[model samples]
Target: MSDWLDEIHWNSDGLVPAIAQDPTSGRILMMAWMNRESLALTAAEGRAVYWSRSRNRLWRKGEESGHVQRVIELRLDCDADVVVLQVEQLGGIACHTGRESCFYRVLRDGQWATVDPVIKDPQAIYAGGHGHD
Candidate 1:
């Protein structure tokens, strides 16, 4: 059967690295994994859906934290081994840590430093006991 998913060069575990980017700022928000089903669902649903390796299931962005990513565009890398989603991050938060992005650390003097401040308290964001990470 002909399928668009076949074009992607998924890894042995049937997963591809997906990057989420803020279309407005062009800043990378997060990176996650996506399976065939999740990618297809993301396209159909017009949202960012990822494969949660830890949970062993599909994860719809903002499902628990109300930080949904509305996908603006989806792209495959030149190698066809990576997926990138240009998205409008809902609530302006993309990290479970309540920061704007997951890559919030800066490497300085051979050490990692957290430079981004949490816009909203994680305690307040995940008040209902939903796991963020």
Candidate 2:
């Protein structure tokens, strides 16, 4: 297992991009970064863990909003530089902006368009505060 872990191609920043998708629905939830430690934790715990570049720390999905992702499988790309996490999403919405996915907006005809409606209100979900105590 260690040898396989070592084979992952982490970037210079010691991070890899991880894309999360719904296992049952086949919907892409979001994309995040992961370090070696985060990847290990996710594998061991059956949960999705990510390294937040903005916060400069490890973050467990749904830590705040109870929107946690339960990992079903982890896939490494051919280059081993990218990871795809098949997960069972607890919450319906995945985007911080209350959309089902982060890719709610799309650029069409050289203009940005709202491709989908907001599934939930982020403010309302986080209003009671995150799950972390």
Candidate 3:
């Protein structure tokens, strides 16, 4: 029998864009890439797991930080290229920049303006490092 993972149309990099959304508020928390293994792990573990292109490995969401995303639902777009994950953000923070969402910048007069405040200092969240992988 064919596997469910086979249904996805991965890109040339063998990855798809995964969007994490807050189930309660419907706010987009973050966006990351997911490979076959990471998507399987995320489903099996009931948490968010992404493929880190920079690190070239599986990145478990909140592996370092204490802000794990409890996945409530997983949805694939009609094209089978994009995925949307409904999750409960444990620490009320999502962005590596310490904001609730990665979409913290807004266009104003053709300039990017920061709209969301940092919920926690990135220094505090990453522990000696500056950002997430």
Candidate 3, residue 78: the lDDT equals 100
How do the residues 1-133 of candidate 3 rate in per-residue lDDT, one tens digit apiece?
9998999999999999999999888889899999999999999999999999999999988888778999999999999999999999989888888889999999999999999999998889999684683
For model 3, the stretches where C-alpha displacement exceeds 4 angstroms are: none
lDDT of 3: 0.92
Q: Give the alpha carbon lDDT tens digit for every residue of 34-121 in model 1.
A: 9999999999999999999999999999988888999999999999999999999999989988999999999999999999999998
> Which ranking of candidates, highest lDDT first?
1, 3, 2
The deviation in Å at residue 83 for candidate 3 is: 0.6
Candidate 2 on 60-121: residue-level lDDT in tens?
98888778889999999999999999998887777877777887878999999999897776
- Runs of candidate 1 with Cα error greater than 4 angstroms are none
Q: After superposition, how far is residue 4 of candidate 1 from its true place, in Å?
A: 1.2
Give candidate 2 regions above 4 Å deviation. 128-133
* lDDT, each prediction: 0.94, 0.86, 0.92
TM-score of each candidate structure, all chains considered together? 0.96, 0.91, 0.96
lDDT of 2 at 64: 83
Which lDDT value does model 2 have at 40? 95
